[model samples]
Target chain A: MSAPPTPPDPTSDAAMTRRSFLRGTAAFGGLTALAASLAPLRELSDFSSTEQFLQKYYKEMTPSDMAKVIARIEREVQHQYGVRPHVRDLKPMDGVEFVYCLNLTRCIGCRKCVHACVAENNQSRNPEIQYIRVLKMPHGSMDVEKGDHNYKDAQVPDKGFFYMPVQCQQCKNPPCVKVCPVNATWQEKDGITVIDYDWCIGCRYCEAACPYFARRFNFTKPEIPKDRLNPEMAYLGNRPRKMGVMEKCHFCIQRTRAGKYPACLEVCPVGARKFGNILDPESEVSHILREKRVFIQLKEEMGTSPRFYYYFDK
Target chain B: MDPRPTRPGNSKSSRTNLWLGGLTVGFLGLAGLFLAGTRSPRPARADIPPVDKKFLETTPWRQTYADLVKAKEDLSDYDCYGCHEKNKPPPIRFDDKGKIIIPKEHANIVMGHGSHDRNDLCYNCHNEQNLETLQVRDGRQVKFDNIPLLCGSCHGPTLRDWDAGAHGRTSGFWDRKLGEAQRLSCANCHNPHSPRIPPREPAPGPHTLHETTPPAQPGH
Candidate 1:
């Protein structure tokens, strides 16, 4: 049997005042407008997932954790770029100290190394990031202050100019590593200064501290074409970095640690670039240090003790 | 609808069969002719001549003395004694301007090595007694592969710098324990006839985001 007809609660309709309904509608309208105003944030590409947020610091992660992290990175890269990347976390070798020596005489101001580094490192293409900067210095002056970065000569090694390709010097006393508030960047045992991109807070202190102007900051999401993405990547080196992270040359840690020459050194047409372990006395860098004359650090007074040295052929 | 007893050969089905048989034979004959025509190989890629492939080359071609030796055994390509008299030394002739007249055979080579044509003489490096060997200024005989020693005789300081890793290009591994490191010879980079490094077109410069202002001058 149907129950006796229950009386409607007074608050259901009788208690709803016109003024109360108007107030409720105003509140709902305000919330909708606020949410609509936040639509631009949907375009921000650097939104972190739960997994990314909970990832451990580079030093704290164990071998198993690193493997999982690398797998995750590969999966993310594949999802974003439609290409599976070979990402690795290469450790620095024992009893090795890499040093770079640039022969000032041989460099013809050709910017091959600059573009090669960009291609090898998976650097951004649109807002165009490059690791190496080739300077055109005047013939008579040894001072770099007289150098020009934007010499648009049809042929290189212009009669009165010399080229100097500069990147991260991997200094013994790196100021970039020192200024990291989050301890995201540090110098390895092999003297290579590296950054943990995930751990960086993007304060850009390191960028300010870098004396050589080596550090590059990503103002927006890096736009890498699917075809141009380098399949080979390193966790601390050439791996694709996210927005708001700082990146710089790590001496091509991916290749050098695997007993291969840096991309910049390999692509230099004139062979102005020289890279080898300074620890090995028989290495080319050692020979250059022992015999070459007029070895000049970019800023000796800064006392960075850079691993990179430039010399003139007297 | 009209039922009638038809003759076997002139029947529509037999006529169609004949047409099908003729078509099959004609197709088979054409296919057999095509197969026979392609059976003999007429030089693979004969139409495509070897491209110079120098468009992308930033540096000059590698023509090292060692490479020359590896390319041809017994050095028949550079056999000076193959044409000249084995016992007699090749005669040296000079033009009116005191410039050594390189023979028509060696016209491919340009002689402008040193200033004032001081090193235009072929005998300066080539051994006069044995055409197969090279002689340094100190009268020590060297082989074709050992052109560095021959070059080092006059370029003593440059040789010392090269040995010490101050000159030329060194490639391969940085650590000897890890892998092999190769140091290029003098001829690998510089032409023996003309040691000067030629000018090259520079790679494209950086394209900055903001094109309004000039780029920051790099100080290095």
Candidate 2:
């Protein structure tokens, strides 16, 4: 009523109005007012500019940090889906370079990996993020599937269509990094590139600049149905992305940090995906890329130096 | 929230009502929360139908929830108590002197540990501690691991096999290069409570046990 006293600056990002503060700590006992006030509990699909105001991308958000971010996500999920979704801690590996590989020959166009990726990364529903694109390549002609993945109109087989899934290369020298007008997107020491969504001005330069077409923009405030949301959230990668921002595949950093394989690699029905640390010579991905005759996406020209490698058995 | 006052009415009554409403809601909310916190830790097995009754035997197995299979017609329908039970089938059996013994059937029960020596049980490494505890990282509290950790007790050989990938299942399919590193849980392969033994080698000639072992030579 009286300028709401500026919400008292949130008292160092932890303390709040004593009423709400005590209520959240007592959430296990059901802080009914806090739950009722914050849950919003509606089908929050309308991605208006109003939502963009509330949604801060990774770069802008600092204090309430990853824990509060996850807590907010869990509360939202619990309110919407009646299930507690877990947001995982997706952090870059230390001295462990993340790399991905696809067996283009084995991928059979079955979208099990896509569904797995959607669930594991906690991407929004209704225009879900397919971290890996499985395009139907023309037989004996790599040129057919080499085009963009956004082909519409019930992609039935024309003649000899083979599926090829494309995703972020976690490139060694990512061009998208160079193209950023603002220093919003940067590569981590672990060889993975990340975009601070808050810092991004929605300029979409990184999306266009990526040679592999790995980056995606949030045209709307992305709405994840509580039921469909994956709880395991990462910090920079798939942590409930906001509207009017750009995002891309993060190689499931959270899962990898915890000594677990990426969700897509785990759920591939045909074992089409492989992931590991490239720096570790003993890592599976390193051995595969070293031993196998692997093909890089656009090996000749762009020279972005992507970490992703592909091969198919003859 | 700024009050844009849709209707022009009261100078004092509406404001008083708003504050009163806020206080009333806050009081009730806090009261309910306090009641919930003070409630006792729930008794685990309060849900399953009584074992004394022929409920388990009469109920036909339902495969809906992989963790649970009940033998009852109402299972397809519903039983409110089933959830309280946590679907824990009655603790299998006890031994002499009241110490609950691991069943021999459990020894043979390998969920899929054939790739390893299939004798490990659930509690080999798992104890009372560390279950359901949350590890806070990056301001988030995730679990220790998804699958229940166990079977590392007496089978150190298998543990290393699992960690380094000489043996044990990967989460998905087998690969020659990547196969050795991605590890899996002991339960992914073998059933802990009821396990199976390796089949005996067939007798020679489908006849008697007349086949003799090769003589033990002193040194080859």
Candidate 3:
């Protein structure tokens, strides 16, 4: 160079290059930080596959599409649990509306129904996911807030305490169904609130929306023992759910739709849990609704209009 | 236009100090989160029973008297003809205080029928005329399988509830159009000798995910 160049004036265009260089450096650093922050996404354990990502909504799926989807699920289940599960998408029966009646006096606070539900449904054993929560309420009290489910008594029917098992009420006007931003959950014609696990974005808005605390979140990949996995699964019922999805008691869609009593009803030693079609005048549930005194719906003030009813036959 | 004005607090040295403080706080927060995330799960309570095969097994202790009779090959095991004459009712001895002295041979039968032990007489349920038949209050004869009829005579309200499916277990199918609805008889659940159902051990409570302590009451 002929002569050393003098320092550029602070106000001159000559200083623009330095300023631009610093700006470029800042931009590069910001981009690198953003990339580093997003690195955790690569380790997503339950990332959706291309097929699952592209799957249509439950209502939109045709019979053929449903069959293909079921087959794919069956294959995936076989690969994971080493067992081929029979996954069928059962449609709601015409002229049938399900109603459940619980005889509060007959329930002896025995949690047999709870365990039976877990065994019937392919729920995770560790970090156990149970739909039914049997609350032990004090005598002369109907308030649910005063109830406790964690009492570890040597024998049930604890003195001065009665039992009330709570689950999805299957509301006529379901708040959970309405709050779903993704429309992943809906009430079927049979009055059963069903969740489409595939379409769920794991927002947990429905869980918050529910007043009875019925919905459960798959916080992690469900850990069910191979032997404990129920092979008789329905697509929107007892089928094994993946991580980051919402699930709840579907009133045993697979069994009830096929005209079989739910596992909870079958196992209840006291015969407290009663389920039947309200449409049939001769049905047991109809007779119960007509005859039983002191019948009350859980949280009727919430305007949920639950299909489930509790009665005291004194 | 220059958006940031040079204030006393926004000086170069103060700004650098603020950046250092922010970085340190961020690092500490991340470290705390990492520790919390990596912490081991709380040990399960020893008082809680493990959900084993026995705990999970559900044997509905309700078998109809008719079904039990049909299953038994030896009718004499439950038949009145085994110990007494077929047509005549067996003679029962009474103590001085009017309590029936149950024979040692039938020690298995506990006579605690009513709340105050009022309906404990053998002839009250079993027919004195014909030992094979059950006697209702109206003298209507009921078979062993139709014990609900015999029990219904006294427990009219319970009988009405049972008839309307408000009482007793109705298993099988809820919809009778599709399958049979198997309704359990009254004697299936309650022992005729002792009508009160005994207390039973409840199944294990819920073990929630990532909870160190016992699961807090849900939805409270």
Candidate 4:
């Protein structure tokens, strides 16, 4: 569609030689600078190729493959923490759909559950990663925006205000799992949304997608003391996460799988937290759902279908 | 081959006798060792306090609830029957303004129930005849552990909620097949005399993402 180029003039040969020499020098200089800057990236190349890139989709892996992967993770944790962790891949229990109910009237605004969760989950201590965030809301109001999360009161159950502790709702239709680009997060059969730390590319798409603000991104390597490190861990739950990953409460998978309550439920001083399988009619959570005026957070037309419920006595 | 070598003292019976003697010596040696082991002293006991029987029966998670009763027992020095058995105290004593007067014995008690105007008399909850146990609307005696029955007569809705797992703290297994569930008594959380829970220090709240200062507000 365009015209052909004209022939080069014989007299411009010297100019052409000089132009090529300058271009060559500039290209060489750029390459040298790039190699210097990228020197640190070479160390991370092994992690990318061996772990992240090679990780198959969770559903694609066979049982034998999962065992090998769990073994490798156990070795890596032992090397990093100098502690032999019991990393297990616990499947969902049959006929067990976990649900949690919190009594708003009895919660004394005690943050014991927060600290207990951190200790049990092996959360970063210095950066202070906690799953449960108790909001202090005023009396006769359910608006979380009007609530103060950083209240430092001399006494709790303050005359005109009440406390509402919020955490992962463990929604049946979790937005966090839906938004994971690499399928790094998914809901287990037992109604817990779990994250595969090594597979996550730290895109933070799930963090943005979560309606409950439940997902937490590991901006840096989680710093926990050697003494405080919880040796008990789960492959898809509370195992030590690498830097640049996403994690949230998995309902204490390590303990709950062993037929024990979550650390938060056990540590609550007022026994406000109630946890049980919703499948059983005789469960405390079932009783609460059937009898109490149970309510969920962000119960709009969004329809996340959360498992967490809050109720108060008349 | 040995048919002709049979002798009276050096027969096969002599070899069998030697084996039996060795077995007898080994058995006696083992018996002596066992007797020596049993003579050793047992390990010394640690100076730990006696564990409460209630705590031992209940799960460890419910130990805090058990501690509430233990703490009350530690402080309850005044016996209710000490004066009630010997001397007859006035059941109701009102001043000229019809305000309830605190007797010398109950002057230390703080009555902070907000609705004191309607039911201010002590006999409303405590039995005038028997001061040890609480009384219900139908004049039925209820133990301290069964205070919910007495409280339910007046607070029918609250009692219903409590039974339905809507009110009070229930600790232990949700499944009855796994373990026993322990519901805390009313007196575990609230003071019986005052009823109103006093204000206490709240645990530290959540640290915000940016650590921004909370907006200044009235009555914070």
CA lDDT, every prediction? Answer: 0.78, 0.54, 0.81, 0.71
What class would a CAPRI assessor give candidate 1's docking? incorrect
Off by over 4 Å in 2: A1-90, A144-159, B1-169, B172-220
Stretches of candidate 1 above 4 Å error?
A: A1-48, B1-60, B68-85, B213-220
Candidate 1, A1-314: lDDT as tens digits: 99997655545765564434554555554454455445444444334556778899999999999998898888888888889899999999888988899999889988888877877798887667788888898776767677777778899788877788878989999999888989999999988999998899889999899888899988767778787788898999888888889999998888898888898887777778888888888877888888777468888889899999998777
Which 10 residues in a row give candidate 3 chain A its minimum summed lDDT?
Answer: A39-48
Considering only N, C-alpha and C atoms within 3 Å, which residue pairs clash in candidate 3? none
Q: Which regions of candidate 4 are displaced past 4 Å? A: A1-86, A105-108, A139-141, A269-271, A295-297, B1-78, B86-108, B114-119, B208-212, B215-220
For candidate 3, write residues B1-220 as lDDT tens digits: 3323546755775666555555545555555554454464645523333366655554546566687777774556466676777666678888898887889888988888896877778889988887888898788988888898889888999998788877887777776778787778887889888889988888878775555565565442
User: What are the per-residue Cα lDDT tens digits for candidate 4 across A1-314?
Assistant: 99897555534553354334444445554454455455546535523337545767777889888887888777777776788888888888888899989988878786767777887898876455779888888888787787776778777767777888888899988888888888888888889998888778899998898877788887656667777688898887788876788889999998777677788886676668888899988777888888777765455456888888888754
TM-score of chain A of each: 0.92, 0.72, 0.86, 0.85
lDDT of 2 by residue, B88-168 (tens): 432435457443456563354333333353423333322213323222222233232332323443355545434543233
Against the true structure, whose lDDT is highest? 3
lDDT of 1 by residue, B37-69 (tens): 545553332121211223224343566658766
For all candidates, the clash counts are 0, 29, 0, 1
Query: What fraction of the true Cα-Cα contacts (under 8 Å, chains A to B) does candidate 3 also have?
Result: 0.52
